[model samples]
Target: MRGALNNLLHGVRLICAVIALLAFGMSVAAAQVRFDKQPLTIETGAGARHQLTVELAVDPQQREQGLMYRKQMPTDHGMLFDFDEARPVSMWMRNTLIPLDMLFLDDKGVVTHLHEGAVPLSEAIISSGGPVRYVLELNGGAIKTLGIKPGDRVVSRQIGSAG
Candidate 1:
C-alpha cells in the first residue's frame, strides 16, 4: 500500500511539472508579439478624421496569425497588414474571438474599401476590390463610430515595411 501511494504521488508531480512547463512556453511565445505603436489616421467626408495606434503585422507569419485567439483588444489599438506590393488582398477571421472592421488601402494609404463588423471566427473572405498593398483591422463597429468611409485615408510610417 505504501509503495502504491508513493507511485501515485510521483505521477501527480510529473503532471504538475508538465503543466507548468507548457504554461511557461505559452508566455514566452506571447512575449514575442510586439505591440509597436503607429498612428493610423482616418478621414470622413464630414470634414473630420480619427487617429489610432496600430501594431504592424509586416510578415507572412504574423499576417497569418493576425489577431487570432486574442480575447480582447483596446478600442484605440489595431493591426496593420503590409503586403509590400500592390495586389488584391483577401482576409478571413478564422480563430479570432472578437469582431473586426477591415480597411483595404492602396499604395498611397488611401482607403479603397472596407468591411465593417466582420463576424468573429468567420471564414468569410473579405477582399479589396482593386489592387492594394495595406490592410487595417480595427475593433468591430469602429468604422461607423469614427465615421470612416470608403474614401477616407489611413497613414503610418510602417507602410511598406513587411519585415
Candidate 2:
C-alpha cells in the first residue's frame, strides 16, 4: 500500500508539471504584441513613389531596443525609431543578424541621411551628420533597389498614441 501511494503521488506531480508548462506557454503566446501593417510612402527625386510596411517605436525604451536580437526581418517590414526631440543620432548593429539600411529623418520626416548596408553584429557607429528625430531600418538592399536616396521625403504613421 505504501509503495502504491508513493507511485500515485509521483504521477500526480508529473501531471502538475505538464500543466504548468502548458500554462506558461499560453501566457507567452498571449503576451506577444502584434501591430497592424501600415504602408510607408517615400517620394524620391523627379516625383517617384516607393512604399514599405514599417513597425513604429514611439517611446524612448522602444527606440533604444531597436530590433536587437532579431534573427530575421521581412523584406517589407522595418522599425521606425522615434525621438521626442531632434538630435544628432547614431546606431550600431550589435547582436543583430540581418544587414539593414538606416534612414535618418529630420523633424519633418525628410530623409536627411542614409546609412546603407549596415553589417550585422558590428559596433561601428552609423550617424546622421545633423539632428534627426526619426530613424527607419529596413533590409540592407531595400533602399538601393527602390532608388531611395538622401533628401527623400518619407512618411509613416505611428502605431500607437503617446497615451
Candidate 3:
C-alpha cells in the first residue's frame, strides 16, 4: 500500500509539471502580438513616391510589442505607430532582431525627423527630435534607398485629414 501511494503521488507531480509548462508556453505565444495592416505611401520632396503596406500599432499593447522577435521584414513592408496626438516620442530596439529606419512625422504627416539604420537589439533610445504624431519603421537603409528625407509626406487613411 505504501509503494502504491508513493507511485500515485509521483504521477500527480509529473502531471502538474506538464501542466505548468504548457501554461508557460501558451503565455509566451500570446505575448507575441500582431497588428492590422494598412496601406501607406511616402511622397518625397523630389517627386518620387514609395508605396508600402504597414502594420498599425495604434494601442499601447500593440506599440509595446512592435517588431520584437521578428526575424525578417520585407523591404516594402513596415510598421506604423500612431500616438493619437502630437507629442515627444522615443523608441528603442530592445529584443528587435532586425535593423530599421524610423521616420518621425508631425500632425500634418510631414516627416520631421529621421533615424536611419537603428541597430538591432540595442537599448539606445531613438528620439523623434520634436513632437510627432506618427512614426514609421522600415528596414535599415530604406531611407536612403527610397530617397526618403525630412519634408517627405506620408499619406495614409489612418492619419485622418493628413492622409
Candidate 4:
C-alpha cells in the first residue's frame, strides 16, 4: 500500500507540472498588442484615396496617453482620437518616443489642419487650427510620403455620422 501511494503521488505531481506548462504557453500566446483595430480611409481629393488599419482612442485617458511609450509602429498602423464634439484641440509630443504626423479633422471628416513630422518628445503645442472632432496620428513624414494633406477627408465609423 505504501509503494502504491508513492506511485500515485508521483503521477499527480507530473500532471500538475504539465498543467502549469500549458498555462504558461497560453499566456505567452496571448501577449500581443491590445489595440482595437478598425478600417479607415483618407480621401485625398486629388484622387486615389488611401485605406488603413487604425486603433481608436475614444476616451480621455486613451487620448491623454496617446502613443507615449511606443518605440515602433507598423507603417500601415495609426491611432485615431475622437473627441465626440467639434472643438479646437491641441497636441504635443511630450512622452511620445516616435515622431508622428498629426491630422486634425472636423466632424465632417475633412482635414482641417496637418502637423507633419512633429518632433518626438517635444512639448511645443501643435494646434488644430479650428474646431475638430478627430485627430489621426501616423508615422512621421507619412503625410508627405503618402501625399496626405489638408483638404483631405478621413472615413471611419468612429467619426460619428457624416453630413
Task: Mark the regions of model 3 whose C-alpha exceeds 4 Å error after superposition.
Answer: 1-32, 161-163
Writing each residue's lDDT as its tens digit, candidate 4 over 1-163 gives: 9999999999999999999998777445434334577999988978867889998777776777778777899998899998888899999998688999999998888998999989999999999998998999999988988888788989988775534
Best by lDDT: 3
Task: Candidate 2: list runs displaced more than 4 Å.
Answer: 1-37, 159-163
Model 4 misplaced regions, further than 4 Å: 1-34, 160-163
Candidates 1 and 2, the one with greater lDDT = 1
The positional error of residue 87 in candidate 4, measured at the CA in angstroms, is: 0.5
Q: What RMSD does each model have against the real structure?
A: 4.1, 7.2, 5.3, 9.9
Ranking by TM-score: 3, 1, 4, 2
lDDT of 4 at 5: 100
- What TM-score number comes out for model 1? 0.77
Score residue 61 of candidate 2 by CA lDDT.
54
Q: Supply candidate 3's per-residue lDDT for 103.
A: 97
Q: Which is the better candidate, 1 or 4, if ranked by lDDT?
A: 4
Query: Which ten-residue region of model 2 has the weakest summed lDDT?
Result: 27-36
Report the Cα lDDT for candidate 3. Answer: 0.92
Better of 1 and 3 by lDDT: 3
Tell me the lDDT of candidate 4: 0.85
lDDT of 1 by residue, 76-163 (tens): 8899988889899989998788999988988878888989989998999887888999999999998888888887777678763433
Q: Give the alpha-carbon lDDT of every model.
A: 0.84, 0.79, 0.92, 0.85
Which pairs clash inside model 2? none
Give the least accurate 10-residue stretch of model 3, judged by summed lDDT.
25-34
After best superposition, candidate 1 residue 77: deviation in angstroms?
1.4
Error of 2 at 30 (Å): 15
